[model samples]
Target chain A: MPVVELEGVTKAYDGGVVGLQRASVSIGRGEFVFLVGPTGCGKSTCIRLLLKELEPSEGEVRIAGKPLSKIPRKRVPMLRRNVGTVFQDYKLLPNRTVYDNVAYSLEVIGEGRDQIRRKVPDILRLVGLSTKLHAYPDQLSGGEQQRVSIARAFVNHPPLLLADEPTGNLDPETSIGIMQLIYRINRTGTTVVVATHDKEMVDKMRRRVVELREGRIVRDQESGLYRPDESTTEFAIRLRGELGIGAEGHPN
Target chain B: MFFFKEALRGLRRSTAPALAAMLTVLITALVLGVFIPIVQATMGAASDVRDRVVVDIYVAEGASPAERESAQRAIERTANVRSVEFISKDEALARAREKNPRAFREGSELLGSNPLPASFRIVPDDPTKVGQVVDRLAPKGPEGAREPQLTAIDEVRYREEDTQQILSVTGLVTVVTGGLALLLVVASVALIANTIRLSIFARRREVEVMRLVGATNWFIRWPFMIEGVIVGFTGVALAVVLLTAAKESVLEPLSDRWAFLAAPDTIAYPLLVGLLVLAGVAVSAAGSGLTLRRFLKV
Candidate 1:
């Protein structure tokens, strides 16, 4: 069974502003999927919907076979506990050390001190942030901060991890490191869904790419490039012409 | 334990606002502590004065000895009368001389006979029922009549106007103190809540991060509640210390200077302190709880 499924989900805000319409996507356990779209193309909206932060106006959202609408208000935290999230800005608590930031995830769940002591360092090592455990968020570089964010998100070992523009602020070299980290995390049987706008990274990874345009899913394919095929749309044709390159499938 | 640790850390981070809230609690408790005793003491003094009031019935000078004796007997037999002491003419003269010795010595040569009249001092079973006893003993006369309808009784006095004034003043004192106390309580709660809100506002981003990380609503709120309790307990303890100091330095001297208006001893000191501490903690916790209700939407 798919670990995450959205069947014809539609989200409409006040004044009939469409956030996402008829957006259906599914991912099985341990699969890495990329959610790529332009700004305001419902990328963040999908993440918000999956987190149950915003309810869909129509259709069903099922995470791990449990319908989101059926989950009580009091149980939203339980749902979130199972789904780890990473953000673009690396929302680390400024007052806390890297170790504390990662341990906070387990602390909120009332994990024992021994469990936290054992888990926090292990996750910090996984994120390659073991040396920076005692450093504060401001004391770290942008890439280091993102690593701390990853450590925090993965500390609980949630089965499903959603990253929203995780490397949006980093340079290309640093972005590669973050992508590799996420890729390594997904290899451990955790289904990873990443919403990003980095076309080069998406093309290089060549994972299942789901493209959204104007709040609608325009493309979903295995080993898909960031842009559509040249013949499909004027935007893609002009983009290919500008780059002076023939239509060619990205290498696996 | 995590919540408590977080609360202690939060307190250290937001020391200024936390201290402000504690100061507000201290001031609130201090006002209550000082005013409560004053109110009790004032009421006690009023009641003491009320209890001292008695009805004095003077016997007419020209009345026969049998008539005077019969008047005394009549006063003693009144339903509300607790006791009656008959003062003879000689005893009345002696009392008058003792009250104004120089005047009596000079007046005794000028006047041949004693001017003071024999009287009955009537103590009522209930101080509030003194008027009833007086009515039963004094004979009713026509309106504006200067003389008593009964020939043996010359006059009846119970200081009705003074008693009325005392009662009205006591009522006014009670009402004014009650209103002031209520206003102070509301102001204290608001001040403390606002202080807590300022600290919460400072840490709102942290709260949002906690919520997004799947912390329960109570998990987020427990730290704030613990902070409030600490502030409350500390403020009340300080206020109690100040109150004790004031009692020794201020109230004790005042009670000595004004011996007639004695301080109330009805409430034990320990009990008063315990109640103040309880009130302080309750108000502080309630203030924080109320403020958190609006901010802890997660």
Candidate 2:
């Protein structure tokens, strides 16, 4: 079974506004997937649904083949132990050091001090932030902060990592560097789902891309590039590739 | 434990507020510790003076010893008198000599006779009943002599000066110290509550992150609550120190200044500490709980 599966999912917010409309997708373990859509196309909402921050108004969501509702409330934290989320805004707590921010996930799960001291350094090293462990979030550059956020997400060694526009605020070089770190982490058997409008980054990575338009899945394919329907789509198609058209009837 | 470290780090960020809170708790506990015992001691001395009051009932002239004994029995049987001791005319003069040696030595030369009257000293159980017993002893009939034959009681005297001083000081100190303690309590509550609130506000993002991480309401709330308790306990410790200092320097001297005021005894020390700590923890918990209600709920 897929690591994350959403079937006939619909989300209608308060005041009768619909966030998503009957969306369906299955993300397998160890797969790197890109969720591409225009702004307000329910990308963040979809991420929130997977994070169990919000329950869908209709249909069911299953994580690792267990329905989200079937998991008891007491076990929700444990369920989150298997999934890590990163925000484009780099939700690093401003009051905490980089090491503290990374160690927070483990601390929430009641890991001992020795375990945190041992594991936080390893995770920070993994994210190329070993030297910046003592730095506060405000002191770091945007890319460094994003790296800290990534470190916090991956510290628990969760099998699934959700990135919601992970590079939304970085320069191209820094964004690429972050993408490389994410790719490296993904290679270590963590299922990575990145939500972004960065067509160039998505195409350069060349992962399975799921394209959404107006809250519905427009396309899902492996090694796929961004489509040209929504914002920056034309740029995505140009940055990546397109479906080859044959000149002859049978073979090109 | 990490949360506590986080809390301590947060507290270190602003030393002044922490100190201000600690000082508030200290001053409050000191005032409480001192004010309570003073009021209690004052009340104790007042009641003691009131209980020691006795009414002296003089016997009629030429009354037989047996009649005087019966009169003493009657005085004892009265509802207000706790006990009655009869003093013969000679005995009265002798007691007077003991009280005033010069009065005994020159009494015959000045008066030309032994004119002192025999009296029954009446000790009333209730201090308030002394006046009633004196009134009852006065002559009831217009035709009768001003002094009755079997008078219920006579002159009523009490240690009024000492009791009055005790009562007045107790009342004044009670008002002043009660007001001060109330003010300090309010200040402590506000200081502790604001400190915890600021800490929670600083960590609001982390709290939200924990919520997103699927931490239960209790798990998210526990750390802040624990941090509040730590703050309260620390404040209480500082308060106990201040109270100890006040007990030695202020309360002891005050007790000496008024010997009737009981010493700051060691027995009340544990009770003072217990009350201060309990109040600190209760206030901290209540304050943190009220402030975190909004954040803890899903």
Candidate 3:
């Protein structure tokens, strides 16, 4: 069964603003998918939908083959525990050490002391932060802090992982490291979905890319380019370049 | 158990707003501690004053027993009369002697016959209604010729001016003091609640992230609520300590000067303390729950 599926889902907000318009996509287990678009193109909306943080206006959202509409509000937390998530801000408790930050996820789910002790250390080591266990969030670099966030997200070995602009605040080199860490996690049989603006990384990875434009899915391609087949505006620009038209001023 | 440990850990790593919430609760509890006694004393004093709004109707000393009996009945029939007691001339003399034995000792012995007039003491059910009893029983005919109207009665007096003055003054005192006390109590309690809200608001981002990581609402709520309870308890404890230290040094000396403060109806200090503790714990728990709800909407 597909691990994530959206069948004709729509999400609309107040003032007639539609966040996602009849967008449908499905992801099989262990698939790595990137949602790429410009700002306000509904990338975050898609991520929020999968997390059940939003209610689709028009259709069905199925996670792990169970319809989201059927899940009671009381059961949402359990659903979240099984879906690890990362964000751009590296939402770590400011006062907690890196080790405790990762351990918290386990503790939240009522993991036993032995299990928490075993898993926190193992995950911190996996994220290459075992040496920085005692370091507070403020004491770490942005890259290291994002690593701690990722470690916290992945400690439970959740079946599905979602990252929204995971490297939006990081330098290009650090962004690559974060993406690599995410790629490695996907390899462990966890279905991964990323909503991002890093066009260069998306093009370099050549993964399945689902591109959004004004709340609608404009393209869904396997091994897709970030700027898939020239859009009308891009096509116009290319034609202009070839014809030796004015580049800086409109040809009158 | 795990949540409690988490709560303690949070308190140890306390922020400025958390400390502020604690201070607000302490100040609120302190206000209540001192104000509760004053309120109790004022209410007691007001009631004590109200009980004195009695009207006395005096009958002529030369009147026959039948005339005095009819005079007593007229006082009883007056409007707003709760009860009327007849005071025979001899009994009136005896009460006067009892009240001031030294002053009456020689005076009463010298009088051949009891010079005191028989009287009817009137008590109204409502103190403010004392004027109604006075107006109905007092002689009301043309000034000099008023006696034919209430022939057996010589005078009907309620200290009407004094009764009216007491009613208005006490009413004003209660309305003003009660209104001020009410305002202070609401402001103080709301301050405590808002301080708790601000403390939770300071950690809203932390709450947001926890929700992102799939923490249940209860999981997010439990630690903060526990933290609030601790803050509230400590704040109330400090206030109680301050109040206790001042109870004898402050309240006792003041009560000696203010008779109403030592009245039997005053609220027991221990009971007031218990109520303060309960208020602190209750306000803290409720404030935390209500404020955290806004953040838990996601």
Q: After superposition, how far is residue B176 of candidate 1 from its true place, in Å?
A: 1.4
Interface RMSD of each: 1.4, 2.4, 1.3
- Model 1, which residues run further than 4 Å from truth? A230-252, B39-163, B250-254, B259-262, B265-269
TM-score of each: 0.77, 0.69, 0.83
Tell me model 3's lDDT, rounded to 2 decimals: 0.85
Provide a comma-separated list of chain B TM-scores, one per candidate. 0.66, 0.62, 0.81
Give the winner by lDDT.
3
Considering only N, C-alpha and C atoms within 3 Å, which residue pairs clash in candidate 1? Answer: none
Residue A140 local lDDT, model 2: 94
Task: Write one digit per residue (lDDT tens) for candidate 2, span A1-252.
Answer: 799999999999999877788999999989999999899888888898887777899999899999887776567777776788888888877667898887778877888889999999998887778888888899999999998888888887888999999999988767777888888889999999999998777766678998887788888989886763445756555434433221111210
Q: Write the per-residue lDDT of candidate 1 for residues B85-162, one digit (tens) a residue.
A: 889889988898999999998887789888888888887887767767766666455774344546799898878887
Ranking according to DockQ, highest score first: 1, 3, 2
Write candidate 3's Cα lDDT for A1-252 as tens digits. Answer: 999999998999988999999999999999999999999999998888888889999999999999998988878888889999999888899768999889888888988999998988898888888889998999999989999999998999999999999989988667777888899899999999999988766866789999999999999999886887648776665555534532222211
Q: What is the C-alpha DockQ of each candidate? A: 0.49, 0.28, 0.49
TM-score of 2: 0.69
lDDT, candidate 3, at A163 = 96
